[model samples]
Target: MSRVCELTGKGPMSGNTISHANNKTRRRFLPNLNEVTLMSDALGQSFKLRISAAALRSVDHRGGLDGYLAKAKDDELSSNALKIKKEIAKAQAAA
Candidate 1:
């Protein structure tokens, strides 16, 4: 799988590593991604996703997976996450 967050779309960045002698070397700054299985109350199921640490914290801050998916922007989420967001919205609308 790619090094990208499923929810937040966080990806690796390119940068230079400087040494004491002012030598620069190209390096990739990878996001802190974790494969997590989060339970969705609205869907009544648990799904596995590869998300960044920051996204994980934001999900917790937003009050769980459902809340995060509902509030997150479409551009910030992966295709699968967008689908989940739609499901959550539909479930909410029907309730």
Candidate 2:
């Protein structure tokens, strides 16, 4: 799997590593990602997603997986996450 956050779309960023001699070297700054299992009450299932720490915090702030998916921008989410978002929406509409 790619090093990308499923929820926040955080990915590896390129930057320069500067030395004390003012020499610069190419480097990659990777996002702080963790594999987390989030449960969906509506679907009665759990999803394992590789998400950034920031995204995880935001999900908690939003009140859980459902709330985060409901409020997240579709463009920002991964294809898998987008599918879950659609399902959540359908479940909510039905409820």
Candidate 3:
């Protein structure tokens, strides 16, 4: 998958690196991502994703890695497990 934070919609950002010497260069800002395994209570299984540290912290604060994911909506590609995760993430932001 791409280097993106699924929950926060964070990805690589390009910018200029300014130096104290009044020089500028190219720079890239990448989100703090971690490979995490979220569980799907609905499916009684687990899945993984590369999410931002903030997202992980949010999920953890709401519950646990798997606990939160246990809540997203099930659609075409959104399996019961995925839906649970999405739901939990949404709920976290609202809170």
Poorly placed runs, candidate 2 (over 4 Å)? none
Alpha-carbon shift of residue 20 in model 3 (angstroms): 2.8
Model 3 C-alpha RMSD to native: 6.9
The model with the greater TM-score, 2 or 3, is 2
What digit string (tens of lDDT, one per residue) describes model 2 on residues 1-95? 89999998999999999999999999999999999999988888899999999999999999889999998998989999999999988998899
Residue range 14-51, candidate 3, lDDT tens digits: 99999999799999998898988876444455667677
As for candidate 3, its clashing pairs are 71-84, 72-83, 72-84, 72-85, 72-87, 73-83
Off by over 4 Å in 1: none
Deviation of model 1 at 20, angstroms: 1.5
Q: How far off is residue 59 in model 2, in Å?
A: 0.4
Ten-residue region with minimum lDDT total, candidate 3: 72-81
Candidate 2: worst 10 consecutive residues by lDDT? 39-48
Candidate order by decreasing TM-score: 1, 2, 3
For residue 80, model 3's alpha carbon misses the true position, in angstroms, by 11
